[model samples]
Target chain A: MEIRIENLTKAYGDFKAIDNMNLTIADGDLVGLLGPSGCGKSTTLFMLAGLNKPTAGRIFFGEHEVTDIAPEDRGIGLVFQNYALYPHMTVEDNIMFPLINRKVPKNEARDRAYEMAKMVQLEGLMKRKPKALSGGQQQRVAIARALVKKPEVLLLDEPLSNLDAKLRVETREEIRRIQQEVKITTIFVTHDQEEAMSISDKIAVMEKGVLQQYEVPQKMYLNPGNLFVATFLGTPQINVFDAEVHDGKIYCAGNMLRSGCMVPDGSYKGGIRPESFNVTLLPSAPDAIRAEASHVRMTGRELQIRFNLGANEFRLLVHSDMQIGVGTPFYLTTREKQILLFGQDGKTVGKF
Target chain B: MNRKAGNVIANILKYGVLIIGALFTLMPFLWMILSAMKTNAEIRAIPPVFFPSKFSLENFTTAWKAAPFGRYLVNTLIVTVFNTIGVLITTILAAFAFARLNFPGKKVLLTLLLATMMIPSEMLLITNFITMTKLKWIDTYQAMIVPWLASVFYIYLLTQFFAQIPDALYLAAKVDKCRDFKYLIKIMIPINKGPITTITILNVISNWNSFVWPLLVTNSREMRVLSYGLVQFQTEEGSAYELIMAASCILVIPIMIMYLFLRKYIIEGVTQSGIKG
Candidate 1:
């Protein structure tokens, strides 16, 4: 089912948790609500699940407004961050609970639960209680219980936050697999960019209760809507510098980095991704800024080199085979397309 | 080696104090049981005997025949069982509401309810008695069972336990289409087995030993409970200390047995609440 959230707002006294957020999730698409803590991503998920009421909004599940509907009637399956499995119930019973609540016959409910357990690879563990299961196993049980009812939409709230690093990766892949197999429209809330980017067909980046951008992971990474989206999406972070645009030229720290920039002449913020910086061992190169390497560390297949240009420090990712040393001077250059300029108000300027 | 010796000495001192305390508490019950097994002459001897000269079952037979002790036991069990069921129902509902539901003035309402705990229950006895009289419920089972159905302390205690359940579970239940009462029965009550068992045992014990209300309201022999029946037996068999001791043993033994069997749950309940709180 497609979901449309129209002008949703949730206010706690004077504070608005989600402020007039509008979004439309396509049918059977796995989207991610990505943001830092307290950015209202989880709040939006709860509202979608009908666990929370919006102060002013209309939520539609395929053109039927369900803003006032109760959570159980919303036809959604929500997995909590901690799994929230009933500790007193065995896995089979837990999965069968929703079916039984709907008054399905006992044998049918049991069969459906067994089928769900098998799908989640918990076939042999149905008799065990949640406390006896490992974190990953418990997570699978939660998913099985949520899916046994065959909900149209599946909502997950930081589902892998409780698992270890290796388990998180594995479980996310499992979740993606389940979502694909079920062909359900899934929207998972996550603060981890990699987790969101790895699984979501589309990512909605949020900040301070407002939607910043919504696009495919690659588009969101390569062409952010604003400064926040740029800095929030990438690891090691995008490097930002105070700059001025004059005579259709972009100048940073007294160097004319790019000319013929199609933006009005004024002060602007210049951003460059860490991997966008090109490093050269020679002391001189065309339009290359001189930088002194301050730190170098090998990270898997890439070498992370932190360098100093005048008074500012920056980092860049290069092939691990490069032999770079600390305190060594090098020339740094970046393509014009890699440079992102934001106006004084933080919105992206004209395209490169 | 010195630290180990100090630890051993501390252990001895701790257990020594505990043993003395246990004996002090057990001495009166031990005396009652010993006295019950003695002959009348032995019990009333010029110098009291710590142990019976020869144990006899004659006092028990006499005590059993003296009054309708069996009838009293039956009456007590009926009142206790009914009252415990009523208490469990009322307490669970009230505690769940207090712990989970949101409403205007919820805090104020709970505060007012808790404030009733400060008024000594003895102060309400007359009012309750008058209400019972007005309702024409005196000398009836409802007279005893209805008045004590809801307890503020038990409600507060179970509220604490219910509140410790994560809100996520409640939300999950809500999403699963489970109603509030069903969730309480299926999840909350079962999850809190220890605390519920503790309170049930405590309530059963309290109802078993209740004296003042039963004595006040019950004027007929057929309606009297065990505690009141024991008192009546004492007065009727005055100066027959052996038979009185035997009757006392009969009244107190069941509660002691119950406590002994279920003492683990009681301790677990207290510790769980203490640590969680």
Candidate 2:
């Protein structure tokens, strides 16, 4: 099912959780609602699901107008973050709930539930209650229950946040696989950038209930729309330094920095991902952006070298096992393609 | 030896205090039982008899024969069930509304609902009695049950439980189009078993013990409840003490059974709800 949400707004008295938001989700597209907590990604997803009544909006599923439709009639599957498994029921009963509610034959509902349980690798645990299962197992049961009705759209609200890190990765892959097999129009909400980037075909990044940027994950990572998106999308985060344009180059703390088209007109803040900076021995090239090595820590695969650059201690991720000492001056180079410059208002100024 | 002996004496004193407190609490019921067994003359003796010289079941027979107790037992049972069921239904609905839904007057309505709890039950008796009388519901079951159809304390209890439900569950239910009358039955009601059971047990016990309203409204002998019947038992012509003791025992038995079954829930409910953080 293709979902089109237009001018969706939800207000709680004076506070507007979602404000005139609009987005189109293609059929079979595994789109992600990506943002920090309370950014209205979940709110938008809820409004689309008809769980929340929009203060003002129109929603369409394919050609059908479902703006005011009841949630059960919308034929959407929802996987809650806490799973929301019917604690009173066994796994089989939980999965069979929607089917039974629809008044499907009892035997047929059991068959469908069994099939879904198997699909989610929860076949052997069908007789047990949710409280008896592990977190990952319970998550699988929740997924199976949601999908048992063969819903037209699947809405997942931070479904993997409760899992441990190793389990999160494992279960997310399972979720991705399930989505691929089902090919339903899916919207997964998460504040975790890595999780969204790894699974989603398209990501709708939001802030303060406003749609900041909606694009494919690769494009979003390679080219974020604003400082928030840029800083939010990267782990270890993007390094933002205040700088100004003078003599056709950006100058920072009495040192020259690389200038792309962003420097031509005026001053702007520059963001560089930690991995964007390459460090080498001082003797390799004397004229590089010079910094004093202050601290170094090994990260198994790479050395996270903390160095002082004009009273600011910035970090660089270099290949592991290069013997380096404190107070040793090193040359740091920024990747031209990786540099992101933003205006004072925090919107993307231009690429370097 | 000195310190150890002092510690032993302190432990004995603590136990002695607890046992005395327990005996103090239990003395009323024990005396009621003992008085029922004693003759009126024996009951008035300078030193009350703790145990009758000769046990008798005579008061049990007289209490039963007086005031149609069988009918009163049925009346009390019906009123308790109807009152509890009514309170449960209304409290769940009102609580769910306050916890989940947004309406124009919701906050004001909730404030008003909670405010009713502060008004003492005795203060409402005259007006409530007048209303029932005006409605021609005097001596009717509705008179006994309708006034208790909604309880503010029960609503507050269920509302606290309902509010604790994760938003994700509501969201999941909504996405599936479960937000109608169906939502109450499917999502909200089923997930709140703990509070519902706790409320049901509480309402049942209160309704069973309730005396004032039933006494005021139920003029017909058939409309009298167990508590009213107990009053009637006392006024029997030439009352026998042994029969009254047995009657008191009978009245106390059902309460004991209910408490036995719901003891944990009662304690948990009190601790969880009685204290405000």
Candidate with the greatest DockQ versus the true structure: 1
- Candidate 1 local lDDT, A1-352, one digit each (tens): 9999999999999999999999999999999999999999999999999988899989999978999999998899989999999999999999999999999999999999999998899989999999999999999999998999999999999998999999999999999999999999999999999999999999999999999999999999999999999999888999888878899888777777778877888888888888997778884567788877789988989989997554556789989887788887778878659889888789988545
Candidate 1 residue A127 Cα shift, in angstroms, is 0.5
Error of 1 at B95 (Å): 1.3
Scored against the true structure, residue B179 in model 2 reaches a CA lDDT of 52
Q: Tell me how many clashing residue pairs each candidate has.
A: 0, 11
On residues A256-348, what C-alpha lDDT tens digit does candidate 2 reach at each position? Answer: 666435355566787777888767775355447878778877888987778765655577787887767677777877777777778889988
Candidate DockQ values, in order, are 0.83, 0.45
The Cα RMSD across the true interface for model 2 is: 2.2
At residue A110, candidate 2 shows an lDDT of: 99
TM-score of 1: 0.94
> Candidate 1 regions off by >4 Å?
A350-352, B2-14, B40-48, B236-239, B260-264, B274-277
Docking class of 1: high
> For all the models shown, what interface RMSD does each have?
0.5, 2.2
Which ten residues in a row are the worst by lDDT in model 1 chain A?
A: A306-315
